[model samples]
Target: MAARRADLRSALPGLRRTLRYLRPHLRPERWLLAGGFGCLLAEVAFRLIEPWPLKYVIDAVIEPGAADRSGIVALLLLCAVALVAAAGLRALSAYLMTVCFALAGTRAMTAVRADVFAHVQRLSLRFHGSTKTGDLLTRLVGDVGRLQEVAVTAALPLLGNVVALLGMTAVMVVLDWRLALIVVAAFPVFVLASSRSSRKITSAARLQRRREGELAGTAGETLGAITVVQAYSLERILQRVFGADNQRALRDGVKASRLAAGLERKTDLLVGVATAAVLLVGGTRVLDGALTPGELVVFVSYLKGAFKPMRDLAKYTGRLAKAAASGERIVDLLETVPDITDAPHARPAPRFRGELRFEQVDLDYGTGERALRDVSLRIPAGCRVGLVGPSGSGKSTLAALVLRLYDPTGGAVTIDGHDLRDLTLASVRGQVAVVLQESVLFATSVRENIRYGRPDATDAEVEAAARVAHADEFVRRLEYGYDTVLGERGTGLSGGQRQRVAVARAVLRDARIVVLDEAATGLDRESSAAVRDAIRALTRGRTTLVISHVPEEVADCDVVVRLEAGRVVEYRPRALPRRGETVDARRR
Candidate 1:
């Protein structure tokens, strides 16, 4: 009982939060909702009237009445017509209610899904790194979908049933107070059963949702890395892991279903008991001089009508619990404060001259380990600097700092003497472009891919940028030239070709600062030469930071900064090495 009370307390907050997602969307659809509710009232009225026809037939037409025998056939026909009219009106009202509620629910959930998706995108890399993509997807898609079900299906129907229940109860009381009391007496038992079973059903549903998320995450991770799985021959291992989670979800679902079934059966038993009691008592009253046969029939009909809502309420309890769980998860996600956000006074950065500086910077990745410590470096505008370091020597961390993907735990990074933290993130990022080791391209036309760098760029400008990056030659040779569509991650293109497209994109952006991180690391001899030429063109007049493990790759830099243990061990200008020179360097 205590646990059940605790669950109830928690559910109030969850329901309130979910209603926040619903309330704003209701404004636009207020009239529609009102109309739907009006239809519900009409449907309830029809139901109340529907039982009246039988009552009239029993009392006026079928009773021993010698005076009304002349119009008996007409009276019977009128009752049948009233029955059919009530049925037709009920069907029409039901259709209107369903359509209106569905529209409202769909639009509201869609808005929430969009907001969640956009918020997830804006969340920092740190959060994404710690979170699973599959779980996020499930929350964005499946969980939000459940909220819609709650609104359109469970919530709306439960509301209509409550109204109907109340109407029927009032009518029953008016017809015969004694019979109404007998029916109402069973309600407390129903409520008690529902309250107890609801907590169990809710607990089971929460477990089921959690297990489903885990199962989705496992499947997504396994399938996304299928190549690695195949190479490692871990298919059987992955299958077992997925199967175990699936089994757990199945168990939770079955438990919830079992609880719901038990509650329903209990409700049925109570309703049957109530019905039998009403029959025995009302039958005696009918034989007495107090109650008419028509009045007793009306009381029975109202009794059943009232109990119908109770049955529906019992059935919808499990769905409401599931939606509440999903709502809580969504609320938790939305409430997560981002680690990085712009200050109130942060301003848009003016056009950058790209004098990048790191002053006594430190980066702790929250694991009690520093990725960079007191790393300070300066690169003059238009100067090409090469950052030479082994893996985990804080080279990429420095670039990320400049990009504001992360803020330093200590000290600051500045561009054009303005601290990056004082600038709007969009303004800061707009002036910087990066070409990672593995060039990322969307599944789109070559022209569209290049235009992604500058959405408003003209076709001619795109072609010109492609030419500058030396991508024009190959792009034109494709089956459809610049309009040719590429597969996922630019699968149709070679490593060097993809890199050139990335360069083309950067060239179109025309950002003053460029960071090339191991951009030529995995290319063959011929591909390396082409990529190197493209990099030269890209860095012609831009302040460039080239990160490479190979000493030869950085031989032409105006200055080379070698980092060891997150500290700059060496910084000096170096002349370009000869083509055949074998320059050796130690890893960090």
Candidate 2:
């Protein structure tokens, strides 16, 4: 997992990658996005127009009797009506904007989530072997949620606020030049303060989001492994550790909140100072007859409206920073290149005859330790081969190579005389089926679990597979029979039952080649025999590699290969002698 973490970290990039993901979404909804833009423009127009009525009511209606009072009354009423209409329209526009933005954002997020999942699926087994399921889940669920927040709250609002600020400022300047100048002077200072505070907030937000992911991952891992925690009597220690992590996350969140709040307060203070300065200078101008009192009032009203968006910008910057951090996390996952990939010109394998050959294959992890050194072997069409080796010898690695789980570091692996690398990964893997030592079942019905290896199999086919694996009798005894629900990872079943279901799965695969990695290692003798019977039935016409230590079972196979320290040490039944049989033992 440490190696996986290093690999993921090394691929991290700057914020530009974050913005690129949003572009495709923006492109598709150009019209709705445009409608959103139009709504924002209309909303800004309403904000700027609101003060016109104040100026009219003050200068014309309030003075009264200097003109036709009835006309003035009607005009004032009309302006009041207009103000109400504007507020209503602004709200409606906001709604329309939200609907459009959410639709676009959701579709875009769906695409991103799909791409991330697909990319993870294509990654090499080596990467998954070292990576934690909890951490990967955190990236999928938590990080994507963050990106959604960025889309809905930050990006959309930023666009609306920017336009509103500009529109309101234009209205303020038109009312009174002297007052506008006084108010505008504070603009640079507010921007500078916001920029400085935002930089700090952005930095803190990035760290805070990372910490949150780690906390989520830790919780997930602990809960998933609750059985281990209880078995080892380490529940108290695990809880304490989780508590410490949660405390650290809380502390970081608080720090982020304080910094964000400070930015809001400081922005408000600057806006207030600007308003005061405008009041002082404009009041003097009105007294000297340089501006009318109504005009001064209208200008101040516009100044207030303009500052609203500025204040909103400051407040929302913190949220935007946090969202951007999340965006970065999601984009990083989406951008991860799979360690294994299909060759561009690769084609699917057709009519598999079950002949497998390892031609001087050299396999190893990135670490200097070798798992296979120049080892070559062959399993003839429709033959059963048993691989026996001590732990850390290359039995499992050899099986993995047959299915191309990890490509050899040197040399080649071929199926039916075609290089494994030259065939599509799906094509190669589809020809081979593996039943692992530990039974992995989903939380689903017994029937569903049996059909997992071949989803398209009919109920009759599934039942036949189950019968062959000796699981049908037990399944039939259950209250719901095949429909009985299995709890998490098939926890509802006994260990032997689970193993049988796994055997049923292999039987259902109907692949040309079958590999069982430590198939009967932990089974009781009776259970092992039942499973072995199923294996024998399934491998009747398929090339098979069974990795086992039980010498009695080893004797049943036509070929028995022994490995020691990552090298083939011996081969049985040499008298049968395929032309190159000696090569298997010579590899070292």
Who wins the TM-score comparison?
1
lDDT of 2 by residue, 1-588 (tens): 121122123122434577677687568768877887787787777766767777877778556365887878898898899888877888888888888878877877777778788888888888777777766887787777777876687667766766766776676677676677776777667766666666677777788887777788778888888889899998889888889888888887888789879988998899888888888889899889887777888788778766766676677766777776787777777777776678899998887988888888888787798888898887777777889989889899999987878999999988889998899998888778888888898999999998988889999999999998889999999889999999999988887788889889888988899998877778888888877787787777678888988787677777889999878888885345343433233445
lDDT, candidate 1, 1-588, per-residue tens: 222233244355677887886688668888888888998898888888888887887888547644766577677789999999998998899889989888877877888899899889889989998988888899999999998988788878877877888898888888789888998888767766677788888888888888888888898899878889999999999999999999999999999889888888888999999999999999998888467888888888888888877777667767878888899888788887877788899999999988888888889988899988887776678878899888888888888998999999998899989999999999999889889999999999999999998899999999999999899999999999999999988989999999999999999999999999999999999999988998898888788999999988888887888887787888776653333322222222
Alpha-carbon runs more than 4 Å astray in model 1: 1-10, 575-588
C-alpha RMSD in Å of predicted model 1 compared with the true structure: 4.1
TM-score of 1: 0.93
Error of 1 at 190 (Å): 1.2
Q: Which stretches in model 2 have alpha-carbon errors above 4 Å?
A: 1-15, 64-69, 574-585
List the candidates' TM-scores in order: 0.93, 0.92
- Judged by lDDT, which candidate is best? 1
